[model samples]
Each structure stands twice: as C-alpha cells, then as structure tokens.
Target chain A: MTRMLTFLVVAAAAITIAACDTTGEQAMVPGAKYSMNVEDGRFHNIHATGQKLACETCHAGTEYQPDFVTLSKYADDGGASPGIVDRAACLGCHKAGGIATAWYGGRATR
Target chain B: MVKFIRMIDMERCIGCRACVAACYTENYHTSGAPWNAVIEHEIGTYPNTGLAYMPINCMHCEDPPCKKVCDDMGAHAISKNEFGVVLIDYEKCDGCKYCAAVCPYGVPQYNETMMELYPGKGRTPYENVSDTDRHPTHRKKPKVMEKCTFCWHKLEKAVADGKTDRIGRDPEYTPSCDVVCPVNARLFGDIEDPNSAVAKGIGAKKATQIKKEYGTRPQVYYALVGGDF
Candidate 1:
C-alpha cells in the first residue's frame, strides 16, 4: 500500500513539473538563448509550428551524411564542421535577391 | 578603401618558376596539382618564334563568374572578400565543379587524389604538428575547389598583427609568389593607392586585365604583354 501511494505521488509531481516547464513555444526567429548548432538545435519554436520536422527537410546534405551539414563519409572522429552553420543550405528557399538576401550580404553572388 | 591587385610585367619575367616552389612549400601543395604556375606561350612564325612566360593565377575578379556558378549549384562555397580575395570554403563544398567550369582563367583546381608533400622524406613540420590556431584555409580537403587566395592567410595575419601597411612591402606579409619572383616581375599592392608600386606600374606600362572582353573585370593585370588574355 505504501509503495503504491509513493508511485502515485511521484507520477503527479512529474506531471506538474512538466506542465510548469513552459506555457507555449513562441513564433519568430530564435532569441539569444537559442543556438542553431547541429547537436541540440534551437528549432523548438520552429518545431512547435504544427509540424514534425527533421534537419534534412532543409539541409539536404550528401548521400553518406544527409543533412544540411556535409559530414565526411569516411570517418566520424574528425570535426567535420567547426561550429558555424552552412548558410547555403537555406538557398533552396531563400535565393539571391528573392524574399531573402544571399549568404554574404550586398554581394548578390547568385 | 583598399583595392588589392597584382601587376605582372611580362617584359621582366624570365619564367624561373622559383615562385612555384615557394608556393608549394607555403601552401602544403605536395599533390600533382599546383596552385600557381607559369604558362609558356610561343609567338610568331616557327622559324623565328619567340617565347613568353605568363604567370597564371586566380584573377580575383570584380564580378567573379566562379562564385555565381557555385551559388547557382547551391554549394555556396566560394566567396570574394572585401579585400577582393577569393576563397573556397572546403567544408561546405560538395565537390561541385561548377566553379571550375565557369571560371575564365581556369583557376579553380580540384584535387581528386590524396598525396603527400614529401612521400619518402616524410611530413612537413606544419603537417605533423597539431596546431589548433592554424588558419582554416590550410586544412582544405581533396575533391573540393581550390585556387589562389592571393596569400589570404598572410594578409589576415598582417591585419591581426596590426601591420596592414607591411603587406606588399614586407616579405613576411606579402604573397609567396609575389616575394619569390627572381626578376621582381610580379608586383602586388593596393591599386587604389596611386603611390603604390602596382598602381605606378599599371599607369606607366599600360597594364590591362586578362579577357576584358569577357567582362570578368579581373584585378590581376599584365603589363607589356605580347599576346591577349
């Protein structure tokens, strides 16, 4: 009886903590707290926009490593990409002089 | 406000190719491909033919066709910096040859095979050493586009060291190809500075960009050339 009561209390507490985590995801570009790093993306708000999205939906990388980032097919040890994102991955949607500017501003490289 | 450019005086060039050796050492180019080279052009009749040794490299065009094509291919690895230096981002490059195809100067060299700088002799000190602070450009991979960056690392170092004035004047800051010219044929400096050697050479020798008709607007100029770009 004591074990059953403890389990019920723990479950109720876990639910309360989860509910208090956040009211809702916001809509807009990510703020300073967010990071676009590959590991833990700051795409929470983006993800909350009524669709389950994978990185490959936009990144579309190589055959070996399919994402926006082009990882080496040979090894998993090396630091393939240092830290910065490949802005080029967004070119599919935001072409030069289209709704968005090119990767390097004022260049109009495309 | 600085427009960097190089002026090659063909009248003074003897094609020693010392610059090539220097570049090979500086750039870790142990492969079959060369980042800089001298093109030997033969002029006039066979019986009375003459030779011209034209040094060829990335023109660093004002309107680069290479970058445009790379962008179109969606690789977006090529970038022309504010200093007019053209660079290829290796990590983002998908081994696309669009840049190489559209370049009028044929400057973008792709290394398909991996080779050592010295097979029997062993690795270079720079190669063997692990330097986290080394410039990223030095770590370029094979199968990606490569070209003359006008010794961009050196220039960036110069800037970081607050010695921008030392560039083109100091051997440490200047391009290896520019400094290694035995006959002093290759000139590098800001064309915007009328007092600079490159500007004076361009003015005095009537230097012209290669393939101006192509409208590439190449920053590299040739002075006293016998043939067209």
Candidate 2:
C-alpha cells in the first residue's frame, strides 16, 4: 500500500510537468532561452475607423511589410473626413458598441 | 568604430510594404509585434497635394530610450549587441509594456494572448520559423518585444560563410524588405564603408535622420521628399 501511494504521487507530478511542456503555456516561448517581459494584450481596445481593426491585429508579423494597402485606400478616400468606414466589413469581428465600437467612434471623428 | 547605416530615398519609395511583411514572417514569435511601420502623411494644401510615405523601423538609437528604461528596472532587459543593434531578451521581459510606452516612434508592439500558429494541428511554418532562419543575422526570442534586427541574422551568416565583404552588396545578405523593394528606394550598407552606395548617397544628398531633436542619433537616414532647398 505504501509503495502504491508513492508511485501514484510521482506519476501525478510527472504528468503535470509533461502537460505544461507540451502546451508551451508558459509566459515565454519554448526553447527560446531569453528574458524580455512585454505586455501580450494591451492594444485590444485601440481600433482604426475604416476597418475598426487594432494595429496589431493586421500588422502582426515577424518583419514589416510595406505592401499593406487596405488602410491606404481608406486614408486616401476619406482624406480629412472621419467615420466614413465600411460598416459591413467592420461588423464581422466587432459588434455594435463593442470595445472596438467606442475606439472607432473617437478615431472616425478625429 | 564601424558604423552601419540604412538610407531611404522617399522619391524612390512606392509604399509597397514588403519590409512590413518580411518583418511579420521573420518575427512571428512575437506574432502581434511590429518592428517596422509605415506612416503616410499628406503634405501641402489642397490643389498641390501629395502623400508622403515614411517607413519607420527601430531607430537603433545611440541613446535608445527603450534600453534606458529597460535598464532602470534593474532587469537589463535590453542590450546593444557588438554591432550597435538594440535587442530585447524575451525571457527577462516581464510583459511590463514599459519599453513600448516610452518609444516615441511607436515602434514596439505588445502581444496579449499566446497564440498557436496552428491551434488544433501541430506546429506549422508559423510556429517553427525564427529570426535566424528568416534572415540568418537576427535571432529573436519568442513572446518578447521583437523589432527589426536590421537583417543581422543575414549579416552573421555572411560572416560565417566568409562573405563579410559581400554584406549590403549581396541581395541575400540584405533585409527581405530591402531586397523586395521594386522601386529600389531603400539602401542598406556599412556606414563606415566610404565606397558603399549608402555612403555615396548620403554624401551626395545630405541624408538626415528623423526627429533629430529627440537626440536618439538614429542610424537609419532618409532623404526627404522635397528637393534640398
């Protein structure tokens, strides 16, 4: 009985360790081997007017690309006008009055 | 001291965004982080209007604010490599967002959720790719504040391959964005090399760094849109 209890305890610990390793759920990426603390999700509320998209959501990549054009057209057309966004396309991810809605509201008028 | 420099000719820049894409693919570990950015501003009054496209990357300042603040935390999260490149150690970063807030250029980006490239499936190209494989000169830590390594990985690879002299001149050693630029507006090379195209261009055009008042002493130089008066 004593042996069985010890085995079970060790097995449980092993399983927990294996689970964490497999998931890579730790704050840092697995095997990266560096130390830099950065906020993972602070810009969720910030959204653009035309697309109502956060800068990170679309521009998220390893290196920067200069070919991104979706926002350029909107910027060109709207010129100085605010809020003249494509509402139908924006509503796909952001429902009316969501965090995005408030953010876009301010940018559209700016 | 051998200094490196990047030169941007606004007249030749067509705003293709190749640099932004290369940055994304190379630094996918920080999936939502932007190491390079392009800001388009309209200049002049109505009828004679024009659009100015500015591609901004980490200034790699001589006195980088990001490095100063990171050091203030006593963590020494940021450091300048031997080549004068500012880099962040992801493992030490506590997700504090302090560096991101202090950057005047709004270059550093934050990632909130740890996203798996292929959630249900196993690792994908998006998951396995690192800065080393992407550029060969820049190696980035995942889940950290990653920005442009200025294609340092490529530079390192060139040196290892006994091709140090070929850097900036060789397309493979150049940053993906710089290589893919159809208009040939962006130029990269050792600023210390007097014969390099970047040096010649800078000497010929009187290239200038952005927001010099900030005293960052950015290595990246630019030739303004309007002809020098």
Candidate 3:
C-alpha cells in the first residue's frame, strides 16, 4: 500500500511540473521579455479613445521613407529628422487641455 | 590631461535622432548595431504626463569595468587613451563578449559578421571603405565587442594636426552626434579644464553621471535627465 501511494504521488508531481513548463496560457510578446513592467497584454482601445492621436503625429520620423522636402539634406534610407523627440515635443501636443484628463491607460486600468 | 567627457543638456535636446543617423553614417555601422540612441521615457500619468528624451551612449569611464573584466579574462583588448578615451585594440580582441556581459549600461555591442547591404548584393557607398585609412574606426571585427569610441579617430586626427583646441568646437574634431545636434544640446570637451564650456555647463546645471553606486565613474554627464538620486 505504501509503495503504491509513493508511486502515485511521484507520477502526479511529474505531470504538474510538465504542465507548468509547457502551459500555453501565458503566451508572451516578442520584445516584451526586455520590458520589466508590462505583463502578458498588448491591448488597444482598452479605454476610451478620449483623445486618440496618430503615431506619426506626435512621434516623428516614424514614416517608412524620409521626408526630403525640408531645407536640410537628409539621407533617403529613412534617416531623416534627427532632432525629433524632446520634452518640448511632448508639451507641443499634450499641452493644457490634452493633459487635463486622467488617463487610465486607455481602459487597461479598469 | 584632457579628462575627456561629454555633457548632454536635456533642457535643449530635442531627441531628433539625427545623432543616430550621424553615428550610423560615421561608423559605417550595419543595421543591427545602433551606436547611439535617444530613449523616450514617458513620465507621470495622463493629467501630469510628459516625455524625457534621454540620449545615451558609452560612458567611457575613468575606470572602465569593461576593460577590467576583459583584462582579467586574459583578453587585453581594451585600453584607455591618454585623453581618457577607452578604446578596444581589435587585434588583441578575441570576440569573447565578456565586456558586454559585465557592462551596466549595455554599451558594448557584439557582431558575429559584417552584414552586407543586401546579402550578396555587395556594399553601399558608406559600407565600401577599403580605401579609408580610418576604416578601423568605422569598421567592426566579427564576433568582437564594440562600442562608441567617442569618435576617438576624429579626436586623434585633431590632436595630430595641432587642432586639439578644436576638439569639441570643430565639426572635424567633434563626434558626429555632437556636430549634427540641431539644438546644440550636445557638448564635448576637457572636463578637467575649468574654463571649458562643458565644465562650466556641468557646474552651472549640476549635471549627474549614472551608476556612481556601481563605481563606474562614467565620464558622460547629463544636465537634467537622470532620475533624482
């Protein structure tokens, strides 16, 4: 009886270990491992699109190709706009009214 | 003693990433390796939110941890120039990546092979550097640990030509990142010289260096970017 009970316990423990290792429940993102904060979710529209802004609008130089219309000579292979992001850049859009709302991560907070 | 160092003023920096393009072109770096980066970190919540453009590169410390560990591992590839520039002697390097593993700031980038512009499609204009004498500064050895030279080759030329005074002021002597900055946010010069602009600026703004707790004593100073320590 004792031997049989020990064998059963061992088998159950092994199965649990295997299940934990290969479990598909925690499907992770590619570059997310490098991030210390975010966990398991990359949801969009999780909150009110209270003030949705296009990516390229605030975040500059994200366009596929470089914009060559400016006075400065920029190399074509997507290397334009070296002076794109700064503290002032944020205040440019997220100014007085845009920052007034309490953003709860677009609904992820709830 | 130059005590070479860099100062980045967050107040003026616009995070344009021209520094990135400048580094890429100047170094002849392939796509995978990014020598300079402008880190955009969002601070506070929606009502109080703002962004900080933190441009980072090699610290080029007074006592570099990368050099210490590499030498201990019997690879004496890393050496500091007289002007306090930390350099890697490529011939002595064995591509161990030990320096990369030990670095706190993740400054060292490892390359396994020289990447072509279009895989068997030959090289680009920037990539083709067989004739350039400064190829050592621009090119990388496969499987070796490489990081920012602070554009040491440019500085070396400036010094050799008796233009040491022009190190930080001139485009030829200044690092590409410093020269291309649209806002004049980047400042490089002899930190030891109290009269120099970089030194005075550091003093006036109360610039701070990262990882003093780790005792790396990084030469790179930021005016108002590092979190309150």
Best model number under DockQ? 2
Give each model a TM-score: 0.66, 0.61, 0.65
Q: Which candidate, 1 or 3, would have the higher TM-score against the true structure?
A: 1
- Top TM-score hit: 1
Point out the worst 10-residue segment of candidate 2 chain A by lDDT: A101-110
Name the runs in model 2 displaced over 4 angstroms.
A1-110, B29-31, B116-123, B129-143, B226-229
Candidates sorted by TM-score, best first: 1, 3, 2
Write one digit per residue (lDDT tens) for candidate 2, span B79-130. Answer: 8766667767666776555566556566666656555666767677666665
State the displacement of the C-alpha of residue A35, model 3, in Å, after optimal TM-score superposition. 24
Clashes of each: 1, 46, 11
Model 1 C-alpha lDDT per residue in residues B103-181, reported as the tens digit of each score: 6576888777657676878776766644455567777677777878898989988888988777789999899999989
Cα deviation at B39, candidate 3, in Å, is 1.3
In lDDT terms, which candidate is top?
A: 1
- Judged by lDDT against the true structure, how good is candidate 3? 0.68
The candidates' DockQ values read 0.02, 0.03, 0.01
Give the per-residue lDDT of model 2 (tens digit) for A33-60: 2323323332322233222454435334
